[model samples]
Target: MIGERWINLAVPLALLAVPLYALMADEPFTITLATRATILALAAVGLNIALGIGGLVSLGHAVFFGLGGYAMGILAFHAQNYSPLEIGPLTFAGTKSMPVIWLVAVIVSAMAALLIGALSLRTSGVYFIMITLAFGQMFYYFAISWSAYGGEDGLSIYVRNGFPGLNTLVPIQFFAVCFVVLCLALALNAMLRASPFGLALNAARQVPQRVETVGLNPMRLKLMAFVISGAITGLAGALFADLNRFVSPSMFSWQLSGELIILIVIGGVGRLMGPVVGACLFVALEHWLGGLTDFWHVWLGVVLLGIVLFARGGVVGLLTGKAGPHV
Candidate 1:
């Protein structure tokens, strides 16, 4: 409990300290790195809901991430081109508003999750994993074939999307936006985990039969969790695309899905700060080790292997011992 309390306090302080130092040093790149960590952490937080609480191992979560990215790219592309988007008989003007884009991303991703979960939830074990992967691949190929946005070339935003009064082009300002969202998501995760629904969902994951005997529908619970998870991931995807000012089919790749899972595992499954720690480590490795060697992922693999074999509770567990639920 001591260790957990320290960690719960330390992670946010560390996150705050980075930006302060970067701002004082006039190093915008550091702020950008921190923003990336926050965004990736946000994505992992979404996945944590499904995997940690719901015990749903989805290898296709990237589909939602990519959907969010494309949502931003598509809207911004049309806005920049000064053209309206048309679908069927309806005509819509493109928007560069971040809030609008985020809403679209969440709604689209949630709808996709509902449809996918409705079918994929029918199976269990490896079958569910494969089905999710297949769906992800389908979206990936569709993105590649969809030439209107960029096809295999990818879409590039001419400018950062608008945010009411903030100059998102400023690295620190953008970082603050992302950081605030991460905190809110973490808060929501805490609320959800402590709610009755969360308890039932966790129980369903561990013992579906027991949950069923309690007159709860495990499938419905899982589906709701999956949809919420997708929506959050989709929102992260929108922020990510905005951060990079680019969107590509690669966001839908299975490797990305694997990386999101890795983030949670390396940080600590079911811990609120797990994704935050994992994202920080991942970004640091990608920056430092990546500069030294092209095979940086090989080093990441080594670290992951060590964590899996020795530190199953991840960095948090390593620091806190087997403590209570990480909040």
Candidate 2:
């Protein structure tokens, strides 16, 4: 067990080093690519809590993601305009600090998840999936119609958000920010998995009736997981917007939600670090395929279909032996 834990921890840390090395080697392409993988993996980790561990199939996670991006975009717009986002007398503006952006993203996403989860949890299986997808589409359309922040076009930041002690514009420093956030998300997931609530959540996923019989409310457990998952994913969205120095309604689309789910599925459901491994593989495939051919997505689809049908367990499951306890 100790050996397993060390390996688990070491693998991600070693993976983290790759970006730094790429930066030192002046491999700008690889550095930026790795940074993206890190951020996406963090988002996947958040989804894993609800979809993998809690057994909730949420197809609308992009709602929270887009919300986070919009939070950053809107704030930056107001800041640049030197005007308050006003509704009558009440107004607010954006901040340049990453921490502030992260906090707002978390709060907004958490609240949205609470409301969405409450409604979606009323159903199960395919119904839940459809409802969540609908909610996501609702937000996507809203963004497209709302011209306040570039609407269908998008919003761009004049500069990347700042951190207190770091020059975020530097590629290495920005990668470090993403790396640290990813580590924090992983650590939080680990802690939650080991907690009693996590145990109940896992149980609720496998045996809701038994959980209820044991006097625990499965609904509440799932809802809590859903909210936390949203918050984590939202933070990733904030980082993503900063990475590109832009935000758009496209980020909230159903396709983005599908991709997040795909990451978890390809990584190995319910496994810690599975998302990280999967994100690395996914991004690498995209980069390589993009280089090889313009229609890489066509080939990528074939590969993903093969994994879904033949692999049964994802890449991690194939490598690690599936009989071990869930992460």
User: What are the C-alpha RMSDs, in order, of all predicted structures?
Assistant: 1.7, 2.0
Alpha-carbon local distance difference test for all models: 0.92, 0.87
Writing each residue's lDDT as its tens digit, candidate 1 over 279-327 gives 9999999999999999999999999999888888888888887833432
Q: CA lDDT of 169 in candidate 1?
A: 98
Residue by residue across 1-327, what tens digits does model 2's lDDT show? Answer: 234455567668767788878877889878889889998898899999998889998999999899999988887778777878886888777588889989999999999999999999999999999999999999999999999789899998999989999999988889888898998898899899999999999999989999999999999999999999999999999999999999999999999899888877777778787788778888888899989999987876886787677665576766665633432
Report the C-alpha displacement of residue 136, candidate 2, in angstroms: 0.7
Q: Which stretches of candidate 1 lie over 4 Å from their true place?
A: 323-327
Cα-based lDDT at residue 137, candidate 2: 95
- Per-candidate TM vs. native? 0.97, 0.95
